[model samples]
Target: MTVIDSATENVAHTESEGGIISWVRPKRVDVDLVIPVYNEEEELDDSVRLLASYLLGRTNEFGAPVADGTRAAFTWNIVIADNASTDFTWAIAAKLCEDFPGFIRAIHLDEKGRGRALKTAWGQSQARVVAYMDVDLSTSLANLDDLILPLLGNQADLAIGSRLLPQSRIRRSIKREFISRSYNLLLRTYCQARFHDAQCGFKALRLETARKLLPLIQDDAWFFDTELLLLAQYQGLRLREIPVRWVEDAGSTVDIFDTAVKDLQGMARTRRTLNSLSSEGTGEKENARAKTGANATAKAGAGASANPAPALLPDFRGALIPRKLSYTV
Candidate 1:
């Protein structure tokens, strides 16, 4: 991972006297919100202002709460991941950083791509909880409460907003809906991932877990989310999919056909990795001579002769599936 010393890394880590490491340490203040931007001049300013205002309200403008039993106020840093935008996006982002001081910051990357920008910004952040949402705010800032709730409640290591769940209300075209379903189905069949919606752009991860898994992911585009989730699953990290209300924004950069093909390719790669791991485990057992040759041969024969039926994949059973949201051109 490329480590750049940006304003976000100014937050220092604290150590305890007894030497018990605290993984929930907030580097700058509290939460680090990373938004990767690529030619989002139309929506960038509004989204950042909205997020800043909401965060300020939540922490009482970084002041002590006036009421009894209220939690202490904390800081939130907004990291704008500039993916080499050929627009006024970076200028506006820089202005926000200057205006907000320690509260907002911008990191400019000449390399273009959503995944590349996100990975750069995430690595530079020091918050206990690191999060990224789409530039258009299609998922809305209101749903952020649901995404962070699991992390705050200590029930999950990662949380993602799902537009396919029962409580979710997605607004999109039928063609997009059909393509999304087909992509997810292929992912489950080939990669054995339990996540129902792998393409959702709004996702949060515990800082420690993200630090460990982000490097394992190589994709720097739409496939980035899927690769991260797959690596997280392999490492046994807990994940929660919260229902969300997603409005399809016009002028989206997603090319449905191209993205679908890329997603399928990612799933195939994940499947190969899993198969390799399984084979390695079997090889290790064989080298140990844990069983007699005849027994091993018999077991191998049985495994080979056993039905080659594919493993049962997880069902999208936790919640009721919602209808696709219709969009007007």
Candidate 2:
């Protein structure tokens, strides 16, 4: 969690009239889209340039009524989180930061763990909406609107890309497809989980929701996503699942068998924890269940642009950089 590069300036906190302190976050961006990499030197450069260009509006050919049809211009930046890549991934990320400056920032961690990288980056981010996608860009970039707009509009606390949905258009091998379905099925049968496709690698959350949920996560790897989703449900956070167009690239470096074993172990641990929580209930207010994938006819033209404005909550705030963490794995 070392501050490799402070791409943002820490703004001063301003107070309101009734003495309710407002923590105007250090880097007040609309969204912080984080891409965490372990050893992805080969794919890093092209992916960054591609995604950066889209963010800069260079390749945004599709602004037509996607994701609730709320077309509002908001600020966003990308964070290249390198989690101790043994290859040249770190060097490439640093160079990209130099190339893009404020829009593209890079951070380095001494250890390797996807969850650790995401937690470090998301914890530091005070962006109105914090999001992440895999570097491979397996999911459609157009779906970003679906994943992010709800959080911006306060429609849901968390949103995830789901390849398992019937509306999803995915090109994947039989083995991977089987593995994913089986894994999620196990969660549903054994853990009574409702949300689907926890391993889709595309998700977003409001900064306030992330702030309250992050500290409860323990896994430092792939299981982080599932663990976070489970805890979010336990806390009664509204979760939305959006169907996505995904193409599974064969060049993925993930070790499926090894990851599966580890994931099973993580599931066991998580289930035990959930059981304990069930036995000891809390007296917190229940969260409202969100209706996902609703079809509403958004105003066709410019009228729809101003429909749901991006509203940044008043209390969400954090430091300029994530604090250093202590891990033993």
Q: Which residue pairs show collisions in model 1? A: 170-325, 171-325, 172-325
Give the lowest summed-lDDT range of ten residues in model 2.
320-329
> Per-residue CA lDDT of candidate 2, range 155-231, in tens?
88899999998999999999999999999998766655677788999999899999998999999999999989878
Q: What TM-score, computed on C-alpha atoms, does each candidate reach?
A: 0.75, 0.76
Q: How far is candidate 2 from the true structure (C-alpha RMSD, Å)?
A: 15.2
Model 1 CA lDDT for position 41: 88
Q: lDDT of candidate 1 vs native?
A: 0.69
How high is the CA lDDT of each candidate model?
0.69, 0.74
The global Cα lDDT (0 to 1) of model 2 is: 0.74
The digit string of per-residue lDDT tens for model 1 on 12-76 reads 34444321111222246556778888888888987787667666664232233424332324456
Top candidate by lDDT: 2
lDDT of 1 at 51: 69
Q: Which stretches of candidate 2 lie over 4 Å from their true place?
A: 1-26, 60-72, 282-329
RMSD of 1: 9.7
